[model samples]
Target: MEKKERKRIVLSSNTAFSLYNFRLHLMRTLKEKGYEVITVSPEDGKYSELLKKEFSFFPVKSLDRKGKNPIKDLKLFFEYFLLFRRLKPDIVINFTIKPNIYGSISAGLLGIPSISVITGLGYVFIREIWLTKFVKLLYWLAFRFNRAVVFLNSEDLNTLRNFSKEKSFLIESEGIDIKHFDLTLCKEAKKDEFAFLFVGRLLTDKGICELIKAFESLKKEKPKVKLIIVGSPDEGNPNSVSKGELEKWVKEGLIEWHGFQEDVRPFYCMANCVVLPSYREGIPRVLLEAMAMEKPIITTDAPGCRNVCVDGVNGFLVKPKDVESLYFAMKRMVELGDEKLREFGKAGRRLAEEKYSVEKIVGEYINLIEAVLSKS
Candidate 1:
């Protein structure tokens, strides 16, 4: 009997970090199942090395997430088309805007099976009406030919449904790694200082400004509270806060900005609670990671954000874009004292294991892929 041909899967993302962090489990799981995985993204010196060591890397110039440039976008579209034609992949799995929209169209044109993962609506869908309509129309047309379209959150799924009135596969945001992020064995600090952690690109839409304001208010009342912010300015994202602005906040002693760190476990270890006041999310990884680390969370009531927090249960959920609400949540956590906070953290860990574990998420993707392929 002949051996089955290995399914060649081409994974496309906008950023190297996204491929490295969010899709790591998916890559490993597919490879372990004997699928040939080829990765494409805008090359970074660090990510290029990691990709070469882990999987096949096909470097391509991706559109900057920050500013709009028609010429660059066109070039990127053609570049993806050329690459897709050259690779002749069995399936194309795309994440982020450029890969999902343009890459899906390219794959569709060539009659190849494809999957598009919508991570978040972001500013593209929320801010610009004309662009949103145009993009929605494109998705309605392009997505019709794809084998599957994966959304990180139910809101995104509903949004897609609203646009196309077509059914699509909905998975909770790429799930967390419960084992990898387990906080049971984490070293506890002897000091009594309470720290709060915030992670993600420094974007205004992420509610970083609101977080800063809340932190300032919290600090005035509780001088012992510490705020540590991770992640750097997302140059590709239009709503990202400028480096200068972040620095200004840091100089004012509002919070400690850690810029971009490869490993965030240390921050998690030092933190008593994790907070994300974003306007919206597609199931935030930081909140999941923090939960896995056995840390309580404070987040907004927005679609993806609320899914992670169960109000007074695992964590507190405040209204999005509300600085006073955020401040009060932080204050309440502070008043809960260490023992109550610890209990909340434990509850969060339990939730992560039950709901957001990477193993569970990987299995969902594997099952979906196999199911889709078998149908073909």
Candidate 2:
């Protein structure tokens, strides 16, 4: 018997943190199946070091997270073009905007099969600025040459359907590691006050302001309730909330801003409910993690968000950017009592097990990759 030669697969994202955290399970699964897996992203110090320990890692230094400058973008394009030309992987899968656009185009030019995973339409789509039209144009151009276009939710798929309807694939987020985020590993800490947790980059589009306003109004009524913010300001993003602003909020005794945490499990263990007033998402990873931890959630009834919480079943869905709606929802969660909250959490966990397991997601991806390869 002969050992089978391994086919190389490249997984590219905007940041090494995303590659390590969101796609770690998929990368491990690909390696287990005998494929040589390589990850590409802008170097994120610690996360870049972590990726090198488990798999091949490449840094795209020219890639900027939120920059729209043509010169820098062209440099990124060439960087990817050169990298793909050298590695010559069988297939490349890209996540986020720049990688999906520039990286996919590079692979396509080199005659290598490529797939673009639109993680979410971030700031570019959120605010309809000149950048939005430019990005949409770039998406149309890049998507034209890809082997497959992947979307996390149907709303995103429909938004760019003209460019990718024939080849678009939908997955329920990157998929969650239910076993890792297991509720049994960390029991909810008993506390006298009810706590609301909001995790993710601190950005205006995430509805951080609205959340603060709602929490402030709610605080006046129920002084014991707390809002724990567990994320850092994303410097690259245009909508990032300044550190000064966060500090002022903290000093004002509004929120317990803990900055970013490598391990969010402990924070999840301390909260009564998770809330994300995000305008949109490819399904927020934090909300999914909260569900796996058997914690009920409160999020906006927006695109990827609506798909996560089944309003009143697993959790509550409030209007996006509506402080009043958010406040009322938080109030309901407080009044709902422990028993009802537990029921919502249980329903959320069941949903995570049934639909969003990493194994199931990876299996679907493998199947798609094989099909694409066979046809090619």
Candidate 3:
């Protein structure tokens, strides 16, 4: 019997790392199941090169991740149309904003079906400026012909459902590899240092400002409390805290900054607890990874953030934007005995195994792709 030819699918993202970091496993799975997987993103020499070694890579013209330049976006629209025309992918899988909107719309024009994953609402919904209103309007229009718009949280799903005519699916998360994050604590943590770690892009919307303020306050009382921050400013994010500001924090003895790490397991193992008091999230991956590594988490009670944390069970949930609430949570962590910390860590690992493993997410992706493919 002759083997059936594989269908070609292109994955689109605003940045190359989005795919490299999160979706590489999904790409590999699709390839193993006899699908031709191609990645499309604006070039970053390193991640893009890494992507090529695993699967096909096609670098698109500038997507302008931050700027709202109309001409640039219009040029990008044409570029997507041109790329789709040439590649003739059977299906297009888009992540993040520009690809989710422009890629879907452009691919639709060529009669190719696409799936757009809503990672998060982004600063658009948080700021709620006229620009965001206009962007939501664009999302409404662009998603018109899509197969389905996938949301990791119900809040985002419900928010977009009011404006969109197409079907909405809640997949919950992009997932974390539990085994990869499994840490065998190689070193003993200093008893004097009650290390609190925050891992994510340093953005105002990510609650970096509140975390810093809370840490500074907590440090005044608990002199040994160390704040370890591990991430760089996302220049593409409008809400980003500048490098100078981070340096200032370091100088003030408020934070210990380690710019960015390809592997975050060592950081997770080093900390007593992990924290992310974000304004909102798509089930924050940092929290999941921390859970996998058996570390207690402290995050805001915001939409996606709340899903990972069961207050008084796995970790504490504080009020978003309230520095006082976050400060108190940090205080509580410090006051808790080692046995209580151990209990929180164990429960967190249980949650990670149940909800945030690669195998579980692969199953979800398989189901999603089958459902979409079955439609036609």
In model 1, how large is the Cα lDDT of residue 341?
88
Model 1, span 165-277: residue lDDT tens:
44388888798878778776568567566788899888898888898999899999889988998989977566779989988988988778888898888888888899999
Q: Scored by Cα lDDT, where does model 3 land?
A: 0.89
Which of the two candidates, 1 or 2, achieves a greater lDDT against the reference? 2
How would you encode candidate 3's per-residue C-alpha lDDT over 1-376 as one tens digit per residue? Answer: 9988788989999888889999988888999988999999999999999999999999987698988899999999999999999999888989998998999999889999889999998778876789888998889887886888889999989889975545788887888887688867546666678889899899999999999999989888989889999999998667899999999999998999999888888888789999999999887989998998989999999989999999999999999999999999999999998999999999999998988788888788878876787775
Each model's C-alpha lDDT? 0.85, 0.92, 0.89
Q: Please, what's the RMSD in Å of model 2?
A: 1.3
- In order of appearance, the predictions have TM-scores of 0.95, 0.98, 0.97
Candidate 3's C-alpha runs over 4 A off are 1-3
Q: Tell me how many clashing residue pairs each candidate has.
A: 4, 0, 0
Per-residue accuracy of model 2 over 127-187 as CA lDDT, tens digit each: 7999789889999999988999989999999999999879999987888999899889875
User: Who wins the TM-score comparison?
Assistant: 2
Arrange candidates, best lDDT first.
Answer: 2, 3, 1
